[model samples]
Target: MKKQIRFILTSVSILLSMFCGLENSYSLEENVKIEECSDLNCVRSHIDEINKGIVLLLAKRMQYVVQAGEIKLKNNIVTAYDKKRAELVVNNAEEFAKEKGLPSGFTKEIFQVIVDKSRDFEQIKMDKKSNLDKIKTKK
Candidate 1:
């Protein structure tokens, strides 16, 4: 499990690094090696890089969710939010957060936002596909 997590994180870091088109950006290793955060700007800089990576990773994740929308449409699920699936993700994240010594509530809240965005994205894709199909049928 630890190996799997490490591999996944590494993959995501590579994908985020590429997607950000940040060939000129400071190397992540150099940026993360803060000896000490003595200044506000120092901490903010780290936060900025971390947030940028998170944003790119989330965008890629959303792409998968859009693909899931196609499958849901084909299966007649017709809803983006599968309660069981959402619960599974939340529960896993909550436990992982606890294991990592982070605040469970904060982690859960973040996961909730992610799940909400995923559901909305999927719905958007589903709607677009439906419209395209309608147009083809009409023609």
Candidate 2:
């Protein structure tokens, strides 16, 4: 229950931050009248800003992923990969993509990469914990 609540809260915070950041960027661009992007350089500049924002959001998401891995390790969860959770995540991403007029396949592929990396990180955390325990037991 606690884990579920924590997960939900983390998810909510992520969504909130994404939307807030998007809102700010949208408004800023609107103020600058850069949405039209008449020239190649202007379009490239806008793309650069978008990429930067995406990278920032991904960094924030990974921070939460580390926290989640720690929580799972402390709670004695055995595996980093949760099939049901992964499916739910993909499904949610697909739905969001539909709402935003993005390609479902593109969204699914992107999320699969994110989920795979998250699992790798979680496994690393679990492995580190296991190693520490083995060392402690030896002494």
Candidate 3:
């Protein structure tokens, strides 16, 4: 019960932070019953659900990163990679991992992958826009 409440509150907080600018306030469905994890199967199921939520958040972040690339292009700046920001993100993740009793090396490595993928995502966005511009010029 406690874990469910915590999960709901955490979800709510994330939703509020991400979509605060929007008009409607989001919330978890009141009709859904959150079950307690009493067995290994139940625990694994919850873990899977949590993983899905994390992936969703990552997808949203990717959208924002692409948008940032568009803004950078508009400003005549290249949005390939930002070394300082990447380093800061990994450093912060390492610190958080340590707090959660996770190995720093493993966390840093995972974050490195995330940073690399984020760079690729932004690059793809910038490249696509640039190609369209080139096609327009050629026409």
Question: All models: lDDT?
Answer: 0.67, 0.65, 0.67
Report the Cα lDDT for candidate 3. 0.67
Off by over 4 Å in 3: 1-36
Q: Write the per-residue lDDT of candidate 3 for residues 12-110, one digit (tens) a residue.
A: 344433332232332133234345446768655655665577668877988888888998899887766989999999999889756544444755766
Give the per-residue lDDT of model 2 (tens digit) for 30-127. Answer: 34333654676875565556556766887798888878877887898857888899889988987876665443475676677778777887789778
Lowest summed lDDT over 10 consecutive residues: which window, candidate 1? Answer: 19-28
Give the poorly placed runs of model 2, Cα more than 4 Å off.
Answer: 1-34
Model 2 pairs whose backbones collide: none
**How well does model 1 score by local distance difference test?**
0.67
Candidate 1 per-residue lDDT over residues 11-94, each given as its tens digit? 444443443334344433434333345676865565566667776887798889988999988887777889999988978987
Candidate 1, 127: how far from true, in Å?
A: 1.5
Q: What is the overall TM-score of model 1 with all chains considered together?
A: 0.70
lDDT of 3 at 96: 73
